[model samples]
Target chain A: MDKLKAIIESLLFASDAPLTIDKIKSILETEDRKTINNLLVSLTNEYDSQKRGFFLSEVAGGYQLRTRPEHRHWTRKIRLMKPARLSRPALETLAIIAYKQPVLRSDIEHLRGVDSGGTLHTLLARGIIRVLGRKDLPGRPVVYGTSKRFLELFDLRDLNSLPTLKDLQDLGQEWPNDSK
Target chain B: MKEQLKNKSESPYEVQLGETFEGPMDLLLHLVKKNEVDIYDIPVAMIMEQYMEYLKLMRIMNIDVAGNFLVMAATLAQIKSRMLLPVDEEQEEDEEDPRMELVRPLEEYLQIKYAAEDLAVRNRLDWDVFTRNVSEDTEACEKQDQEFVNISLFELIDAFQKIVKRVSSKHFMDITVDTISVNARISEVADLLEQHDSVSFQELLEGQDTKGQLIVTFLAILEMAKSQIIRIMQHVESGIIRIFNG
Candidate 1:
């Protein structure tokens, strides 16, 4: 049992990103998939019950050990060397630009319900987003898309890795209803 | 004094007739200021002559003036010459001020210049604040990196998906019940390697699919690796993985 636990820890630690049960099973000498799955469950429970600084999360279809949100500030400071605080407007603009990328300033304004020409310029200057191309319209307005730096900051491999709209909507429900 | 005036008239300025100023409006404005003339009542002939002189100097310096400058020069000269002609009552109706068209564009340019200066001042202030924030942010980032692993599981799935996509595109006979499962074959290979110190990876992969089989065998190698029953070694950029007993 101790050997199994040690093996699991080593495997998870050495893994470049994450590991799944099937992967552990295939790697282990044992032919029992159920045993590996049980082991993973038990490990996950132990980690969570202990309230460790790190937690095992099943994300992107694999299990990975990551720092808890409560420790994010300190951990980010220690690891990444800086925590840039984006303004509320900048964050909102970024979110819109990220999800609706290859979008135009006009489209962003329509969604934001505000004139975002200045915000777009700010984002462009910051290298957070860039002009993808000009639209085939009367004015030939430029279209914008998130830059590679966006993926680096978000820790995403590519745009395809973003959670689906349905997942976001479901997550949104977790917040308390503020209608008063 | 009349001869001196004639000599000045024959100078390079007059010699370069119809040559247009690079910045005709600026030159015209400058002339108006120097002569203390009203902008509304610009001395067209004097300004045109001065403008042509400037263009002549620019040409002598080998500077290629743009067509727009030349066009404006022509327009000014035409307006100046037209102003000299005595107009009858009927022809007076045909006359129009060319300077009237320039008024709006010039006013718009001035407004834009002022706005740009204001924006620059604001930007400088914002940049000072931003730099201070950046230093503080860097400290926070350093703390995060030290305490957090910051791993994303998505990267693993992406890697797996790539391998799957590569394997799927190639032609291979599907492993059926009658045929040995890759998992079982891997176990057998692991057991064999447990007794032998080393085995040829290519020899193990023999009798397998030309393309897809390599990946399957590689997967088997990884499986054996997980058990610590076998080990594989390879040089940088070498696709071959040498199998050995653990």
Candidate 2:
């Protein structure tokens, strides 16, 4: 178990990007993904227990080592990077895509009553949203939807965890209406 | 504040918009909320006139009112015209409300706007939970041109695809491959490169055209490139790749 943990650690350390469970398993020539899954958890726990300068985290759909947030000030002093800067328009476009996924671009333009060509391009370039396919309408307009990276970016467990209209309303902690 | 500013201007056409980022829907939603009107039951004529009046101010302030705003204005006018006339009793039973066309989109837009605001908050919170970034993107100056040291595996595959596409048309019959290894093809590519100082990507797959052969050749090319046995360089942007002996 100790040797296995060390091997996984070195594998992660050598990797420049996050390694998914399948990736780790393939490299280690392991069969059961669950065994490796446990080892990853144990490694994270061990890191947390030791209060290490860096910790393994599941980001962008894979495991990668990242510095502790407390130590980010030092990194920031060196270089301040705000990757994926979502402007106001981009965020609005993203929100619409999230709520009504598989939505047509024409429908988005109609809803916003504005040209979304640039905003859509920005979101695509950032890899937050992608063209799911063309809608089965006239001209077969492109449909947009949030990507898996969107889920990871928002730190959401899944799409179902997205805040619905009711979620927004009940954010004030209101009781469900019984009289209506 | 806009009202006070409008009064001082002594011009009915003058209007002050709060910020540059407000979209047409954002403005309409703002009006809907301020009026506390039910989204399902928007007063179209009243809202349309108010919307037009706001546009007057937007125009006075030299704010670029996109055609979408005017389209909505036209839509509102059409809805208003529809509302002015009484519907027949039979038609009213199965008829859709004139205001529904505008109301539905507004409700959806407002919902998403709120959600986006919520997401912005969550995104800030997400930043607190940092992850390891091995890219070292910010280690140097932020605005420096990218150092294209190592190309992505996908980029290499794309280049290989272009080469295979050129060859596939020539050999159309061979699809089934009983035996062909990527490692074997790697040596083949190396030997081919040894014969020439530099080879265009197409020359490497001179004879191989089948899907199986194309794939194997692609794998071999990628393997050699990774092992530093060959250098894949494009003489120009979006041009043919040249494989150089490493």
Candidate 3:
């Protein structure tokens, strides 16, 4: 058990990004998937129990050692990170991609009544939306869809968690001027 | 045009009165809803006049209406001209309404805009959620290494682990007698790097016979990257790592 803990600790510490149990298993040559996962969970619990400076976070489809948000004040002093704020146009483009996924670029442009090339580039760079494939149509335009990273970024459990238009309309019903 | 603009308050043309629109279609939708006009049965002539006035107002304010706005304007005019054509007494119902093309896409776009607005709300929420800064970004070096290949640190680690496993398996001897010091290994790697401005990971470890030599060489590479003497280049598409001397 100590051996397992030490190995996991070093691997997690050395990793530049979040890693999956599968990656660890392959490197450690351990066929026991469940054991590795359980070990990781226990490590996670141990970190929480001990009140460490950092905690294990399952994000972007893998496990990462993240500094505790409470300690962000101290971390922020060294971390001159940009506040990744998306413009209103980018958000609107993201919404279209999220709801009408597997949609063509032309479809997005037609809907927004404007070209969406720049906004799509921004979303792609951020790894929020990805090109799924080329649509089987004239010109074979590229089809796009939200990625797993998208769900992770939005704090959503899955695609099913995306708020529906009916939900938005329900919220709109409270507005004093919703005529129709 | 200026005459109608001055008498606009007398008409029922104040479409949503105070809303900002993202595009021409948005403005048109607001106009349709404000007057309680059916989208399917728009008063094309009246709506066309109302839209032009709105565009004029935008131009005065330097809002910079895009080309689509003018395109929609021409479309509305074309439809209005079709409306003016005398309806044939026979098979008149068979002829399609000119406004349907505009209405259908406008309706579809409006629904999408609603979804987009909802996502914008979620984007605002995401701002509150913080992520860790565990891995440092190589954005600064990325510009310099544009001529060099790009590779991720993960791929480098994966390759190192693979090579280490292969060498360890080739000889099961735990011989720790004459391992080169990490500092000495670093210097040797640096000399190899000085000869070649960029080298592949495999090239650096080539011809090393022992497991200890391979391991030391790998560690030296990692140490070099850590001390900023070199940058690990990962091919963006292939995930192959190369070393670029700083």
Query: Which stretches of candidate 3 lie above 4 Å from their native place?
Result: A1-10, A40-55, A67-78, A125-127, A147-180, B1-21, B28-51, B60-64, B70-246
Interface RMSD for every prediction, one decimal? 19.6, 11.6, 11.1
Q: Higher DockQ: candidate 1 or 3?
A: 3
When summed lDDT is taken over every stretch of 10 residues in candidate 1 chain A, the lowest stretch is: A171-180
* Model 2 segments more than 4 A misplaced: A46-56, A67-78, A99-103, A131-141, A145-152, A156-180, B1-20, B81-97, B123-127, B134-246
**Docking verdict class for candidate 1:** incorrect
Which residue pairs collide in model 3, if any?
B150-B234, B150-B235, B151-B233, B151-B234, B151-B235
Estimate candidate 2's alpha-carbon lDDT, on a 0 to 1 scale.
0.64
Question: Residue A1 in candidate 2 has what lDDT?
Answer: 83
lDDT of 3 by residue, A1-116 (tens): 88987898888887865678889999999899898888889989999999988777776567767667666445544444434545445666788888888888887777777667
Kindly list the per-residue Cα lDDT of model 3 for residues B1-246, writing each as its tens digit: 233223222321222211112466766876786567877899998889988977775443223467888899999999999888988879688988878977888656655556655664452212323444322211222223434343333345447656656654455353444556556877877787788777778777654655555655765676676455777766555655778775
Worst 10 residues of 3 chain B by lDDT: B11-20
The predicted structure with the larger lDDT, 1 or 2, is: 2
